[model samples]
Target: MTAVVHPAALPADLRAATIRTRVTVPLRFPDGYSTSAEVMTFHGLADGREHLLLALGGWEQVLLDGAAAPLVRVHSECMTGDVFGSERCDCGPQLREAVEDITATGGFLLYLRQEGRGIGLYSKLDAYALQDQGLDTYDANLALGHGEDERDYAAAAQMLRAVGAARVRLLSNNPDKAAQLTALGIDIEEQVATGVHLSEANSRYLAAKRDRTGHTLQLSRAGVVRPAKAAAGKAPGHSGMLARVDALVPGLRARAEEAEQLRRLPAVTVQELQDAGVFRILAPAGVGGYGLGAQSYGEAVRVLARGCASTAWTAGHLTEHAWMLARWPREVQEEVFANGHMPLAAATSAPVGSARKVPGGYAISGHWSFASGVMHSQWALLAVQLDGVRLQALVPNADLQLLDAWHTDGLRGTGSNDLRADGLFVPGHRMMDWAQLTGPDNPGSLLHRDPLIHAPMTTLLNLVAPAVAVGSAEYALDLFRHQLLMHKERNGSFVRQADSVLAQARYARAAGAVSTAQLHWQAALSLLPSEGQADAGLPEAQRAPFRLSLALAAEAAQEAVRLAAGGSGGSMHRLSHPLQRIQRDVGVLLNHPTLGIDPILEQAGRGLLGLELTMRSF
Candidate 1:
């Protein structure tokens, strides 16, 4: 009920010594926009500040002297295209750009991370899978039961209070968000332009936001929410599978030893990520959707991670994918999401085949790799390479075959099989260039580059791995603790080994490690909103932290597994043991290229060190 301030945690003397009157920060902008930072100082810094550059384009500071109120900003979240400049949305750039503009000019950003409007990273991805089929943002939301925008500024307001700010100006494009902040008691200092800078990739999205949602862009919110074509009967929120699946975790773990060797992801796992609503995660309100914010999305992921790792990973990925697809043109979406089997769990990677340029569309051919949930997917995304660039082709199962390919040491039940496409025809409009996305100037781009479209892709995809690893570790540790209690209550021993002092030490250690990683997981998710500022000269800083997320999660994953195994003892090695699966799963996760020498991770570490060196402190 009350907000607590968490200023620098150090001696008062040291804190005072480091306190400043003005803060410096890197300004991040969306992929294609640029601006000078002079206005930031005059308008925002008129009173002066003791500031610190928290990130590129994104940061917070004590303003106009310590007595002044604090400020907040919930920068949008979009990784794939955002951090990597993938061209899906302008989120990454917007984040950094906004920060620099606000912090330098005269304000603070609350950084209320709501990536993909709270559909979570993976669900946004599923939306992309649908986008290849042709759906606009609203249509996709309708199909998923996800709101038009899944974001909230509550935490940001809380964070501001922590820094001692009672009232402040809010910088954003959406009037709804600003009003919400004002209602919540966050002082609205002023409204500023945070739209994705113009780029051919995101022109349409900008137009849609301005037109449909009253986004205060150059467009009008008239017919933007209109169905591009016809509504698919399956509209968002129609599917309630995610909720059902999430309820199974605690009960499944109640019978730990017996829960082992359970291959059915549906029957054995319980967590928010695996619930019924998961299917409609990307669908909008008119169609039925929660349209939660990034905090909720991340919270759901964290909750699921407490149960079964594989299940959480699969569910999160599928859910995010659903949202991303929600932003495509209406006709394209209807073909995929509106039919009786519209909510399909299918996708293809690897572009195992080829496509030839043809009239109207490309005659596509290929075998896709790692098509997770292929058995459940009526539609699939097959990646193609044409004109020296990769393009995604959305097609129906009628044109493709599910090939047995997802057999792996971990997450086996995910059904990530390969799809074989001997010869398929993807219409010209059915495909788009991966690099053509730049939010502000989008033509077909904005209409498709919904919030999730801009999220860092590799970062989001890799999240599944960590979620699974951490959840598996949680389940394993919970089982181990339960076993210890049963031994003590029965006044009995566990194979003569459970009574040992080592077991007690390990139990605490494993629990602590799992908890530690979980904390870090939340910490990493918190960084999602601070990726960019509005005034960065380049995209370097925004790119680094997103890259670092992979490593941060990987570290958390390893710590979780090590602690879980340490607590379990030798019995964890049994073939039928759940620990065995967890062990394999974490191991497999460690091998993720994103963690193994990933440039992103390296960049994050560098960024951290660079900032410290620059400021002579954090």
Candidate 2:
């Protein structure tokens, strides 16, 4: 690809336009092919909207030559198809093919912002709903008071002229594009044909375009392409569970205050979660659980947290404990899961207890604090030192005594009380060595086929609390935005809080912080090893970075929540306000032992500096 110089001057007629060059960068494709393209923006076109000009290869030079006719494609923006890869239309594939074709030969592709054939996005969605009601795309637009094709080419013509393209070989199946551009004083050297992109979802839409719009392309109706089916015996996907949880969010948000007041997740909320099958996310597939991967589980937790952080926190820990319990001996797993229903377990790994080894098991006695969800758990996985080895002993709730000592300013609804166990005898099958559980070749690795069950405990355990923090931050941002819309100055000024520039800046900062944290969290989740891969844990160099990323995620959430609370007025300080609760919850979550920033940063710095690790437990 050759580079072309930007024009030094524009013609008298185009001088008054609000045209500016935005960026020129390499656009990479999935096939490893890349090309440089200049992204020029034209602001004063089509309802004061901005249109983009992607001059590929040496197209700008070709256009400046006046006699040379560059290949041009006038493309319309489709948010769903282009950004989301939605197969409801061929827009995404067509856009990809056009970029490849234009890059091969010097050409220009104009990305017009005329979404939904100029009916706008929401209207396009309404049109989609209408299309589902047996109307074609054109008729759906007409039903919405829009023309069959409302997009105009005047902007494309003006953009071409401003870029010094006097004539062009148009790449399009629609002859109307050539006719419209020609009528707008753009000389069409030739009308080139574009290949048809066919799929089951867009077959009818394509047929309508070809039959009614005079588009020239060969399309076949021999077979409709469909997505490949999942493998046999595969568990159902998480979409249904996520949708169920999403539907339950409003009710959970309504009862958040009640949960806080009761110092526990409301019984109704717990029942709703059970009904949604949320606790079974990490259960074994053979036991009728989803056995979702880490990424899917993290996403579900994030979604649940958006409504109520304490509930999400308790739920995440309990679900993760199920996954951990899968690492125990097969007999123990069967003993716990014999009922074919998901079980909730509260856990603490601080090793604040002592266990004495006996012939069959260990006599465990301890008082564990911070036992989140203990009120709802059927069992407890208490960390203890037995015969100089750290192990987790699974004791039935019947043997443990719960103390009424859960008082906290943050995460108030977690019911994270202290539990006392006095010389309880846990069977050998019910205890697991901490080292073996954290290693790659754990008992669960041999018992279950799900790789998520075998994932490194160090990495997986750190993710649960952070997931709730991320969700709470997102919820805080939403609450702040809503507050801004309703807030007013106290001195009788009628100006809305959102109208203030400072508030807008804070909102932007908070949003950016949350997005950055989510990106980091997703990156860490992606590093989990897949099924049948080597058993070695994540590389040492990556371990610290992963740990640091978890801290960053928590810190980012803290920052976002702080910013949101600051923007909310004095009323936000009240206990009834969700913002105050969210702020306090995120604050406590960020202080989690594994999610502290200083320790994580030091470890990351040590790893980057090639120093011997000071801590090796992970």
TM-score for each candidate, following the candidate numbering: 0.52, 0.60
Clash pairs, model 2 backbone: none
Give residue 65's error in model 2 in angstroms. Answer: 99
Locate the minimum summed-lDDT window of 10 residues in model 1: 220-229
Q: What's the CA error at residue 16 for candidate 1, in Å?
A: 96
* Global lDDT scores for all candidate models: 0.52, 0.77
Query: What are the runs in model 1 whose C-alpha is more than 4 Å off?
Result: 1-246, 251-275, 339-342, 351-353, 437-459, 488-499, 530-543, 597-600, 609-618
The lDDT, on a scale of 0 to 1, for candidate 2 is 0.77
Q: Which predicted model would earn the best TM-score?
A: 2
- Give candidate 1's whole-model lDDT: 0.52
TM-score of 2: 0.60
Candidate 2 off by > 4 Å: 1-234, 487-494, 530-536
Per candidate, the number of residue pairs that clash is: 150, 0
